[model samples]
Target: MTVTIRDASLADLSVIASIYADAVLTGTASYEIVAPDETEMKKRFQSVTSQGYPYIAAVDESGDVLGYAYASAFRTRPAYRWLVEDSIYLAPAARGKGIGRLLLAELVARCEALGFRQMVAVIGGASPASIAVHQACGFRMVGTLTGTGFKLGQWLDTVFMQIALGDGNASEPDPESYPGTLFAG
Candidate 1:
């Protein structure tokens, strides 16, 4: 089946919220089992687009949000502007059908369009599928923070994966010197 990838708007937050909450409550895909409600989800969606980061959704016919991806600051410090962290989530039945791959590929493209120089993916240790997905998307394993994330009465380890897209010969840009404004509280 061919899925169309498009920029997610504020109107699409409900379905994106459901997908995220589904992963949080019923799946080990994310370590956080505390699923957020629609209000919180709306804020998350708003934050992504408001900051000029692409919040993309994969939709089947009839515009159902089967999955989504977005990027956010890798670190708050001025040095990290070119570095962004990524998130991809798919509906349960949509798994293993190239939905994740499509969203991730689109995410990298969008981030690059926004002048991002690198991407970092933080995956729960239990999600080898996610790890493999990012690896297949050109991310390399960097390190692991053992027993760092706690959820569902258990501590989960986090694996860090990174991809560098910057021109290797260029000097690092000072994040604060950039004229772009970022949405932050």
Candidate 2:
């Protein structure tokens, strides 16, 4: 099935929250045990987009949200502003179809365009599929937190992967650029 990646809107929050809830409850893609409702999800959507970061949804030809992805501050400290973390969640039917990779590629492109210099993947549960997907999109394993997550009656590892974005660290960013406040740090 053809999947289209586009900016996520409030109208898509319900479906996006549903996709994330499944991951929260059954999958280890997210460390959040209690799934947030659509309202909370909308707040999160606004927070990310308001920061000039991207929140995107992957939809099928029928306009159904197959999955969603986004980038957010890797850390709140101003020194970490140029680095961002990525999150992706897919409907059960959407997995194994390479949709995650496509969504991630788009997210990376968007973040790069926004002047983000680094993209990080904090893959919960050491999920091989997630790890492979990130690797396929140019992410390299930076580290892993052993037994950092407790879920589904077992200890889980969180894998950290990273990739350089446009001109990544090859040159200094212009402080007066698109992502204005960030480059100054």
Candidate 3:
């Protein structure tokens, strides 16, 4: 099945919400116990897009959303303006087909183009699939937070992985003029 990656639109919010809902309800990728409704998801979509961050969807030729990904402020502080946290979710049928890798690559390229210097992945449950995929994309294991989350009748770990974007702190950060600051403002 051919998949196309594109900027997510308001019309895609329902499918995006559905994909995330499945992950929240059944997978360890998301720590949220309750699935967020479409309204809440729409708000989140707007929050990211309005800030000039990329929120993307992977869809089949038929226009079905197979997965989605986005970059958001790693932290709200101004000093963290050049850093972004990435989140990805895929439908059950889309797993293990390299779609995650495709979506993540596009996210990295978009973030780099936006002048973000670092990208982080906070993988819930230290999922092997997620870790492997991140590793394949050049993210190194930063650390894992043990027992940081309680879900599905067990304590879960959150794995942290990171990758450097364009120029990644090799030079001093000029937050005042960086494109990444658009989100900080």
Candidate 4:
């Protein structure tokens, strides 16, 4: 099965929402309980695209969405302008293939091209695949928040993994800009 990665469109929102909702509702991939609708996802896609970020999907030649990945503002502040947070989700039946990797590779390329200097993957500890994949892609586990999330009637851990896309290590962030303020409310 050949998997192709490409830019996601508004029409792909339903499939994306289905895959995301499946991951959220059934699997331990995400911690949210209320599954978002297509309308909500479409708005999300639009927001990301409008901001020049990447929202990519892996699909078969027949145009079926196998999985999706995206990079969004890590923090809204101008000081955090170089940073982004990412997410990847695959269709229930589409796991175990390299689809997630393909989707993320595209997102990384676009994020870097957009001049993003850092990318973070804040992942659920239950998804070892996510952790391993990000590691293979060069993201390091920077922090772990034990019991930061509650899901499936149990406390869930959140892991913070990150990679630097640019050269210098920024020790001092600009104080005037509040982090995570870039996304329009």
The lowest-lDDT stretch of 10 consecutive residues in candidate 1 is 176-185
Model 1, range 1-185, lDDT digits (tens) per residue?
77999988878888888889989987665777688988998888777667777788999988888899988887777667788899999988899988898899889887776677888998875578898889889989999888877776777788899887655226765444332357233
Q: Is candidate 1 or candidate 3 better by TM-score?
A: 3
Quality of model 3 by C-alpha lDDT: 0.91
Q: Candidate 2: worst 10 consecutive residues by lDDT? A: 176-185
User: After superposing candidate 1, which stretches have Cα over 4 Å from the reference?
Assistant: 168-170, 174-180, 183-185
Best by lDDT: 3
Cα misplacement distance, residue 179 of candidate 2 (Å)? 1.8
Per-residue lDDT of candidate 3, residues 153-175 (tens digit): 88999999999999998988766
Better of 1 and 2 by TM-score: 2
TM-scores for every predicted model? 0.89, 0.96, 0.96, 0.89
Q: Provide the global lDDT of candidate 2 against the true structure.
A: 0.90
TM-score, prediction 2: 0.96
lDDT of 4 by residue, 1-185 (tens): 98889888888888999999998888777877889989888888888777867888899989999999988887777657778899999997888887777777778777766667789998985478998888878888899888888888888888898888644256543344322335435
Best of the two (3, 4) by TM-score: 3
Tens digits of per-residue lDDT for model 2, 1-185: 77899998898988998998999999887888999999899899888888788889999999999999999988887778888999999999999999999999999999899888999999999999999999999999999999998999999999999999999899997656647343343
What C-alpha lDDT values do all the predictions have?
0.80, 0.90, 0.91, 0.81
Hey, what RMSD does candidate 1 come out at? 2.6
The CA lDDT at 46 in model 4 is 83
Better by TM-score, candidate 4 or 2:
2
